[model samples]
Target: MSGQGTEPEAMKIVLVGHMGAGKTTAVKALGGVDVDELIESREQRTVAEIFAADGEGAFRDLEERVTLELLADPSVQAVALGGGALASRRTRAALTAARVVWLDVDADEAWRRVARSPTRPLARDERRFRALHAERQEQYAQAADAIVPASHVRRLAAPIAALEGMPAGAKLIWAVTASADYPAYIGAGLITDRRFWPATIAGRRVLVSDRNAASHYGALFEPVLTAVRIAPGEQSKTLTQAEVIWREMARTGVTRTDVTVALGGGVVGDLAGFCAATYQRGMPVVQVPTTLVAQVDSAYGGKTGVDIPEGKNYVGSFHQPAAVIADTTTLGTLPPAELAAGYAEVVKTGLIAGGWLWRRIAAGAAPDDPDVIAGCALTKLRIVAQDELDTGVRQLLNVGHTVAHAVETVTGYARYRHGEAVALGLLAELRLAGADALRQQVLELLEQAGLPVTLAADVDVEQVLLATTRDKKRVGEGPVPFALCIEPGRALTGQPVAPAELRAAIMELVG
Candidate 1:
């Protein structure tokens, strides 16, 4: 609230996450105060000892009181909050007036770090500790003004230092993967904010944009040595277009240090990123995603490619970007159909995330909210960090994309938008999962969002079914590996659905 409109004011930037997230260490690394240390120094006892003597309820009361005191103090710039501090509603509400950064840590990593430590009182039980980590992630993500991986924090100080200077209401999501890591800046006016641009783009830039995005937003980026403008739409996202972009980069004397600015929707992001991935054996890319679908899903993952006749994204590479700047203001100019299409990914993400984000979508949160976009981005970031190549847990992020890609393939990529096909595909996958109630709920939500819950008139059900067998995720001679949502917040990959059931699900989409 302090930096939203009027002149800047003092507001505490608090770091929070599960136990073993290294909050105290991160605070020290950033030169910020640690409230837990302050509390321990006053009590003359460790936090574990205090918890043992006073119990969690009593400890929380003191934590809430002192945390508020620290946040209210004008001199305190930032503080590392206790892991359970956000469990208090009043303290969570107090964060509204503060800048909160969620220092992210996976449950396994947290457990591994704190398991044998005598100082972690509540971390004695592995089962309960993991459950609590899952439970608290929803809170941290919901309250965070920015989300940063715990692995990146000591180094994160540089980016966090730029947090307050971002456009009002802006949010940051530090995306980490096995290949590379980058910062995702989501806000109202990030495109023109030169100060918010990553240092990776400080040198010359070779932009890859579509006709629409170039005419609309291309001129805003300064000192771009050259640009390769291609036709808009998925139809143009092909190796042919990628070759066009490669030629232009070669002609412009582009080199490894120059950045590729992907300035458009998923089409441009995928094609340009593919070109950059191969050009000079991997140059850095800065994804300036201007569409809802791209901002929420494609821009951050580094899975860049073009569609071929065989299947969607059949030829691709794992080329992570140097940065992703999603200026939400661009969403305001999108057509109604594009926004509705984008909402499908939001629903798919919420279903996969299944806790705070699902509740928000069920309650009808708008797709354009920076928090919603950042939530979807963070969910994928967490998945990619663990399984960048989609060889394992990363498949969960494809809960609805398997059939969606098939739909796009059989329909020749023209009958439905990527998100629209995904909306229908979600219903199909839920039907396959036999989650009748959840499927109905998602159906109603998609219908409300103006998405097509049924197959298009020209789509061939049998062809769509055959296309699924050709799915890029398939290996050997088996059926396409399916990722299913058993319930909110839980998903499993590599499931086999019988042919009869697959037909039923696809047929259901027809009606």
Candidate 2:
């Protein structure tokens, strides 16, 4: 708030995240005050002498005293918080006025940094260090309004400068994935980054693009491989397209060692990923999703497939891609309708992943806002990374999709794009069944984002029921486990709703 309207005015920048994320280094870059100097000033007083005056209780008090004193100076604007500061609810609340930046670092790099640094108090050994690191990462993630990856600090300085100019409440986010750990680079401008694309795919790679996405930004990927263009939209996301890509792969003499690059949105990601999954009994796949819908949700996950006349993604395999590249620059070319449609997934993500993230999205934050997009993507990645097979906790990601997918199926996929239909379905389901406040928030966000809150008149309730009957989430001889959005960051499933009630709800939305 203090830096408002001034280009070079000082703003309080607080560093947060897991231990050893180079918070100190970043603070040094900003010419921050030295904490050790303050401690050194009192060197004559031993730990025993300090505790003797107040005991362990008082010693803890002194720590906060020193921290507060350090932050009191107007010139001392930049503060590097200890990794555990946010763990203290009082500390996080006190720092509400400052610009909180969560320094994003991968688990492996963080572990290595802590291992090499002897200054860390909690990281005395590898086993204990990793335990502490993992525990704190989630809390740090929750506390920050914006996230900055410390992995490329120097390189990202220019972008950081640009980000610093954002309004007081603006949020920015950056997505990062450790090398070969799992395919995680699904962000704008990431596909064009040489760091994301390995050298191995140069001559051996083939690119598959759909009409809508291929018409623009297709040239960006031309350097990656020989391009094979396909028709765009949900209709093109079928087994036929998969076969065509397979044929291309075969004609190009692609082998098991070779990779196929999917350079479009979700449809292309699914279709080309399916080809990579089945070809030569499974080959490498790289995803370059051009739309916000694909980048934030579909592209990173391994579930690749084509829709059959029977059900959605019925003919797909769990073939994980080698990497995912998303370029935000491509999003600039999207129609306003497309951008609004994509925000549906962003809302759903908030419903499932709660806290400040839910609050931000509910507040009508734009998807292009780094904080908004990164927060949404981080929630998805955390869930998927923990349970790639979706055998357990990952089922939460399907919130609002059950009825939404049914809407798409019954309407023949053209009435609304996948995201638009989902937005409508979520509204109906929440209005009828979820918590009142959350339902209202979802409705407000839908209206604010310029998406529809009701289904088309032409959609048949009976056909929608029939579509629901075959949902992939159906459990042992009962109603399919539909993720019902109730509270922000919470979902309920396995609650059997009567078919009559569901039909009534769909009818209410109809027209």
Candidate 3:
């Protein structure tokens, strides 16, 4: 069974963007596929002719009915939605099950393509054209699962191909950014496949892992410079452990041209990636995350760091990886407790994403499902691409980490796993934001996943508060920027809450 059970549902690749965004061309580029063009499907008249004969509102009603009818078919594989089709609430709601790809184009470029087309009803009026384009851009972004620039249209075929007939053990997603771009592969036995391994990282590789992980899959690397193993636990994510690895790299003559591969969980990835970022003024790093937490949340993003006694992830740098290979096969070796702890991060991700992903998770989907893992990874990658340095929109990714990090710090990183702390943090933060309905839904999901929903009895509210003061998000003595969930799929960040309210929420969780 491939997680969702039986064969996967045929994914409908719905391309959505403004007029002249190349949605139809991109669909045709993926050869041997059926493309459903909404305008062409109308029997009596074209959409433009309908607008001329009747009116804009009448055209929209006909468009909505036709689009909904087409989307209802299980066999429909590809669709290019009209520019304003997704503006309808029913159309946007219906798109939650399909794969939406936004073909992003600049204003000038988009206008140039459609300026001479009389058949385009909205393009006839210059000012209205620009306004409608701008309005639909926001809607397209909100509804899209992936955003591909028009220039990168050729690269869309690879992921589209993967979705069409995805092999039993292969899953692929592309991570695009202004400075860096890479492919993330999640499969059952990908580490052993030389085809997936980049040739550039074949030599002088520094494999950073822990003793436990090394014991299982250390020999997978071909030409390793050295295998530096640290003690297993969050305690090992320290400056001292990083120094040991740095010394090992120096001893083994690791250089800037060489590559570093992190082969363990989040601890190994964060620690080794930090070294890769600082060593020789930065070196390429390839992440092969072996744990569920690393696979879903920590491994892909460029955020690398080590913990100090002051707070977690206090010292870190933004160094995006050259590539990421997530092998779901390795998950079988994890203990049940470790697996359940990792599921907490999955639940947190689903809450933040809150579309098809949340729907699947809420329906009791398995945590180890490859589609679930791929969806979470893609969500994080998209957020990271927008804000690599956590300056603006990236803060929404820390929905549960504020109180979670404090819990990890106050407990000395021993009592509960990272995801467990995050689970509790999510509840408290939801309470602070007053999202009662979503809070109850998320709480039930967390409980179903066998995750903790409250703090331990011995936890001190004052200590957690003091630790929050030292959080990296704290700025200029103001209250820390807390990410609060207004509802599923919508989160508000940088909200300042009173200490009394914070303390009361924490107390409520414990009591």
Candidate 4:
């Protein structure tokens, strides 16, 4: 929170990531010095030459000495460490002295950039390079104060500077889609820092919140044009509700240039973001998520909409948020049931991620742990960045969502919380995928979180099966493509499931 909104002195900012993550290029783009270049300059030998002659053990020794010296220097405003510097324990320890940003790039993209590069000794083969990339993600996720895509680095000078003010252990995922790029900050005490809130500049902020969130943290962001409050819950998400906010905005002299601040859980975030998308033919919105579901899952993606009578989230648009600020402190005031419900997403995300995050969740990481929260957000942001249009890889994110939405739709969106239904959906989807062992493992996770593991006996299993036919993903009605999970870290989309097996899966969930 240094200097609040004022730009702090351009002090040391360290860039760390895997090779081909553009750490060196980012340093140049950000007008920072490159440590690898300094190493070559001092030794009068290229890094490849150092690697060939001194060997990795000797090269790491030299790297630790030179990297630590540059990091300690007050004159150096920014430094890009060697790609493997995080492998050095001492080098990782010295990172606390300055702001650290991890330039995230997928293994395929990283390989595409470094393949056949003579300067890169480590990128000798595709298999070894990818394994190295996967091995470093957990370390990078743990270390970086901010995670931004390498593609955005050349134009990311502003946000790279903003990293200096983040609290210790706080993480910011610089979310980028093909259409927009924005900051999503996950931390404690971020609300008190004026820098985290987006300024409206000449325009004013039109706050859209539910009564619950407005009562809890609404006053924290005052001086808005108007507080367009709504009742909380999935039942409140509708075209009628959106129109209510729109009329209020029109009455309050809201303009297209104004920003809409969505301050609540998934319901409010979705409904308000939908309003922001259609109002004046699209206005910028800053999402300030107050609930775990919103913070960990719904907040980062540009998907904003309301539920129709047919299904949940059936009406929506891809209106990317201008920014998202997730304050983990808000979870302290959440009810136990609500907090437990949100854990379903944590499990779903962890199962999909199946790495550091899954390991933490498996060991029972609290729902509000800032690092886990940031890690989940980073995971979704990375997925969305690769497929903003939800065409291919992004569909993996809907692993449990298809059945979850069906359960919500069949029950009229009043019976179960979204996450609760999702918990059941995950089990049913797991059963359909014939992953009996994996299903048991995830069932244990649901039990550990105190989330619902089964549907009530009174619920009509037949209706739930019928609802899946109307899923938004269904195009010509050949069959609804289920995103099946056969293992952790992967989910196959567009899999056609038989009616008999689908019915059996739902029957398993019914108590």
Question: Who wins the TM-score comparison?
Answer: 4
Candidate 4 lDDT tens digits, 1-511:
1222433345467888888988888888767788889889999998889999989899889989999998888877789988788988888888776677888888888999999688888988889898888788888888887788888768667576456455555677888889988888888877844435643223688999999999988888778999988987877899999999999999999999998999999999999999999999999898999889998999988999998876567898999998898999888888888898889998888878877788888888898898888888988988899899999889988888889989988887788998999999999999988889989988998988888898988888889999887788988857899888877777799998998998889898875
Flag regions of model 2 displaced more than 4 Å.
1-81, 84-180, 186-203
Count backbone clashes in candidate 3. Answer: 0
Find the 10 residues in a row with the least total lDDT in model 2: 177-186
Candidate 1 per-residue C-alpha lDDT over 7-59 given as tens digits, one digit per residue, 9 for 90 to 100: 32355678998889888888887667887789889999988898899997888
TM-score against truth, every candidate: 0.90, 0.69, 0.74, 0.94
Pairs with backbone N, CA or C atoms under 3 Å apart (clashes), candidate 2: 172-370, 172-371, 173-370, 173-371, 187-326, 188-326, 188-327, 188-328, 189-327, 189-328
Which candidate model has the greater lDDT, 1 or 2? 1
Each model's C-alpha lDDT? Answer: 0.84, 0.69, 0.77, 0.84
Comparing 1 with 2 on TM-score, the higher-scoring candidate is: 1
Q: Could you give the candidate ranking by lDDT, starting with the highest?
A: 4, 1, 3, 2
The superposed Cα distance between candidate 4 and the true structure at residue 261, in angstroms, equals: 1.0
Candidate numbers, best TM-score first, in rank order: 4, 1, 3, 2
What lDDT is reached at residue 392 by model 4? 86
* TM-score for candidate 2: 0.69
lDDT of 1 at 474: 90
Which digits, one per residue and each the tens of the lDDT, describe model 3 over residues 184-252?
Answer: 767667674332464333447899998887887788875688889889888899999989988899988
> How many clashes show up per model?
1, 10, 0, 0
